[model samples]
Target chain A: MKKTELLFLKEDVDIPYNWAAGRYGSLFLTRLRDEGKFIGNRCPSCGKVYLPPRVVCGPCFTPPEEIVELGDTGTLVSYSVVNYPFIDPETGSRRPIPYTLGYIRLDGCDTYLSHFVDETDPAKLTPGLRVKAVFRPREERTGRLQDVLHFKIVD
Target chain B: MATKVAVVGIGMTENKSRWDLSLPGLYRLAYQRALEDCGLKSEDIDAVAFGHSPEYFEGVNHPEKWCGEAVGALNKPLFRVHTGGTVGGSVAIAAYYLVASGKFEVVLAISGNKLNETSSAQIGLSTVYDPIMGRQFAAGAPSAVAVQASKYYSQYGYNEDHGLMVAVKNRNNALKNPYAQLRIPDYTLEGARNTPMLCHPLRLADMCPTSDAACAMIFAAEHRVEAITDNPAWVLSAVAVNEGINYVDRDWSKPIGLRKAAELAYERAGIKDPRRELDVVEVYDAFSVQELIWYEGLKLCDWGEGGRLMESGATRMEGDIPVNPSGGTLCANSIGASAMFRKAEAALQVMGRAGEHQIPGVRRALGHGWGGGIQFHTIMIFGKDKP
Candidate 1:
C-alpha cells in the first residue's frame, strides 16, 4: 500500500437554540428558586409523583394535577465514578476529573433523579444508601437542579 | 391478509474510521454492492429509506440531498428516518412497510455514520438530552450506560468479570467477520479486564467503537422476490416500541421497551419460545453489558440470569443459539448502520450467505436494536421459509 497524503481543515460553526421551559417546568423551577423547595406533580390516574413536574403521565396518558412538595432526602439507586476528563457541552470547558455521578430516588417521588454525587470516591457510594440534596445558598439560587449542588451521604 | 416482504439482497462496507471516503462515496459503495448482489439495476429500486443518527456527527444537514444521487434514488420516494441510534432498524422497518403495503415492489434501505468527521462525538451526543435538565449532566454514552450497569449490578449478583466475558466473546467473534471494525484476533479475559476503565464498572474495551461504514439492503414483496432470488430471507414480523423519555419511569436494567417490542414481534411471528425456536439472534450490544441485558429483555433467559447465560457459553457462535456471529454493534458500530447491520446479518444467516459466520441450518433468526436512553426498541424476525 502506498502512503497517501491527507489534507484536513477545521472550522467553527455556531448553531443557536432557544427552548421553552413549558408550563410544568416553569412552575417547578419557580417554586425551587423562590421557596428553596422541590415540587413534583401527582398524576391524576396513577398518582405517581413526577419530579421536575411533567405535564402528563406517560404511561397513563392523563394530565397531572396539583404540584406537591417533595423531600430533599432519598436513596441511592445507582452511581458511577467517571475516570475520564472531557469537555462539558454546557460550559465548553473541562469538567473536574473523576467525578461521582448517581441516580437517586428522592423521597415522595417515584422516579430516580439523575445527578452528581458530592463524594468522588467509588467506595463510599452504594445502592440504597440514604442521601440528602444540598442546595446552594438562597441568594445564589438559579432555580435549576444545579441549585441543589449535589447529593451527599446522609444519616 | 397483508403483503409479505423478504430480503433479496444485502451489502456492507468495511467498518472503519475512514478519513479517505466522502460521505457520498460511502453510500455509493454500499448501494452498488446491493444492486450487484441481487442482479438488479438502480432503476429497479422504486423507493429508498435512509437511516442516520444526528446530522451533527458528520457536520451535514439534510444529507439525503447530498447523497441521494449516489444511491440512485434521486427522484424517487426517498424517505429519511432519524430515530436516534435506532434509525437503522427503523429504516429497514420503513422499507418493509413500503413493500408490504403493496404500494411498492422494491425498496432499498441505506444507512451509515462517520463519527470521525465530528470534532467530539461524545459531546455531540450529549446535546440529545434536554438543555435544561440533562445537557449539563450527561457526560456521553459510556457514563449514561454506566448508571444502568450499576443498577443491574446492584439488582443482580454479577461483577465486572461478567462484562469482561462479554467483551472477550464479542471481539473474538469479530475476528471471523471480515467487515467488522474491531477484531482482536488473540483476545482473552485478562486483556479485557486490564483495559482502562472509561467509567466505573465499564472499561474502554467494554464499549463500542465509533465506526464509519455504510450498509444497504434490498427488500421486495414476496411475489417480486421469487424472480430475484431463490434463497430469500422472509421478513416474518417487525415492530418498534417506545417508552417515555423521562428516566424516572424507566428501569434501564429491564429495558421494558425492548421486551414490549420483542413480545409484539414474537407474537406476530408465532414464536412460542425464542431460545428453542429461533436459530440465531443479533441484538444491540453497543456496550458489552447490554448484550446480557438484552438476553433477559428478549426472553432468551429468565430475568436476572443474563450473566449466567453468558457464562454458560450458550450464546457463542457454536452454541445452541448463536448470537451476534457477525460481531454485533460492539464490534463495528456505525451508529446509523449498526441496527441495520443486525438485520442484514440475520438475513444472511438464514440465507446461508454469511460465509465464515454462517450458522448451520438457520431456520429462524431475530435482529434487534435499542436506542434513545433505552427507550426506543426495534425488533424484526426473519425465517428461511415464508410465513
Candidate 2:
C-alpha cells in the first residue's frame, strides 16, 4: 500500500464568557448558597412573584420592592423525559440521556422554576404533582440551580 | 402618514441543509431569483434590508458585510435588523417603511440562516437565555416550547393528538411546496406520534427542522407597484410589537405581543373580522404547539379554544382560513429566514402563484412571526386589491 503525504494544521481559540448576576440574581444566588433557600421578588403593582427574581415586572413595568422567601416545595407545572442526549456546556460533556426535567411553580410564587426532576418515569411525572427540591451537600453547593440536586415527589 | 407599499416579487431557496454552499452563495441564490422575477437588474434596487437572528451561527459579528455583496449592496444603502426569530419579518417591515417613506422606489428585503454550518442550533439557542435564571433548564427551543406546550395542554384540555393533526397536516402540505425541507407524502397522525419524544408533549416531529435557506422579496412604492406588476400583493399594514419576557405574568400559551401586533395590523387595514376577511395565513409555527397558540393569539379563535379550532380542520389547506399552505416553519426552519418565508408565502397566495398549495380566489393573507424570548412579534397583512 502506498501512502499519500498530507499536511494539516489545527488552531484552537478560547473565548471566555463572564456574566454579572446583577442585583436580583446576586442576592438570589447568595441566599441559595448560604441559607439553602429559594428567594423571589414580588411585584407590588400586580402582586406576582418572580422566580430567580427579576428586578422589574414585565407587564406593569414596575420595579419590585419586596424580596420574598419561598418554600422549597412546589407543584410540577410540566415535565418531560429527555429521550435524546446533547452536549452540556457546563461540564463540556454530554448530558445524561433519559433524564427527566420539570417546571415547578413554587408555593406562593407565580413563576415556574425549570430544573431537573428526580423521577425518570414519565407516568409518575404529571402536571400538578407536588414536589420538593432536594439540596446538594453544603460542600458541593454551587449557588446555582445545581445547588438543588433535583426536585423529588413530595410523597 | 405612511405611503402605500406592496410586495411585487419574491424569491425563496429550497428549505434544506445546504452544506455545500457558503452564506453569501445562499443569499445570491435567492436574490438572483427575486431580481429575475421582477425583471430588474441589481442596479435597479435602491437599497437592501437584511435580516437574521444572532450572529452565533455564522461565527461572525456582522453577517451582512459577508452576505450583502450577493444582493448587490456594495456601496448603496443597506439596513439590517435582528430580533431573534422575527428578524426576517422585521426586515420585510423595514423595507416596507423604506418604500413607504418614499425614500426608495425599489428596496430588496432578504434574510436567511445557514444552520448546517453551525454545530447544533440547540446549543446556539440555549446560550440566548439568561445565564443565571433559565439557562440550566433551557434545553434550547424544543425544551422552551415544551414548557409552553405543557402549559397550554393543561390549561386548555388539549393533548398530543390535537397537535399531531397539525404535524400531519403541515407535513402533508409540504408535499405540495417544492422548496420545503420536510415533505412527507405518507405522513400520518400515528407516524408523527411515533417520532422520538424530545420533551414532554413535544416529539421530534413536533419541532421544526433546522434548514439552510434564504428568502428575498422586493417592496415597491404605490407608483412602482403599478409599474412593476399588475398582480402585486398590496401591503395593507405591517405592525410589530413586543411584550416583556417574564413568562410569570404573561400567558405563555397565548402571546400578548402577537395579539397586540395583530390588532394593530387589523385596525390599520380596516379589518373588522380577521377570520371572515383574511383568505389565508402563514404563521411562525416553529413548533406545532405554537401554531395552535397563534390561532388564539391571532383571534382566529377565542382564547383557550385554539385546540378545538385545530381539531375542527378550519386552518387546513381546504379549510376556511388555510394556514401554512407552504408547510410553514414546522417543515423548514431557517431561523432568520423563517419569518420572511411566511411573508413570501402569504404574498404568493395573494398573487395566486402558489403552485399546488394555492387556495382558490384568495384575496387577503396574514403573515406572522414571534421572536426574542417569545416577546417580539410582527404581523403583516397582504391583499390582492390595492388597499
Among all candidates shown, the one with the greatest DockQ:
1
Q: How displaced is residue B300 in candidate 2, in Å?
A: 1.2
| Tens digit per residue, CA lDDT, model 1, A108-148 | 98877778888877767778899998888889988787888
User: Going through the candidates in order, what is chain B's TM-score?
Assistant: 0.98, 0.98
Tell me how candidate 2 scores on lDDT: 0.87
Best by lDDT: 1
Let me know the TM-score candidate 1 reaches against the reference structure: 0.97
Clashing pairs for model 1 are none
Give me the runs in candidate 2 sitting further than 4 Å from their true place: A1-13
Predicted candidate 1 versus true structure: per-residue lDDT over B1-387, tens digit per residue: 779999999989999988788889898999999999999999999999998888989888999888999989867999989887888899999999999999999999999888888878888888887787766676887888888898887789898888888888889999999999998889999988889987997999889998999899999998899899999999999999886566455677888778888889999999999999999999889999999999999999988999999999999999997889988999998888899999999999999999898999999999998778777888999999999
> List-wise, what DockQ does each model earn?
0.67, 0.42
Lowest lDDT 10-mer window, candidate 2 chain B? B243-252
Best by TM-score: 1
The positional error of residue A24 in candidate 2, measured at the CA in angstroms, is: 2.0
- Judge candidate 2 at residue B138 and give its lDDT: 65
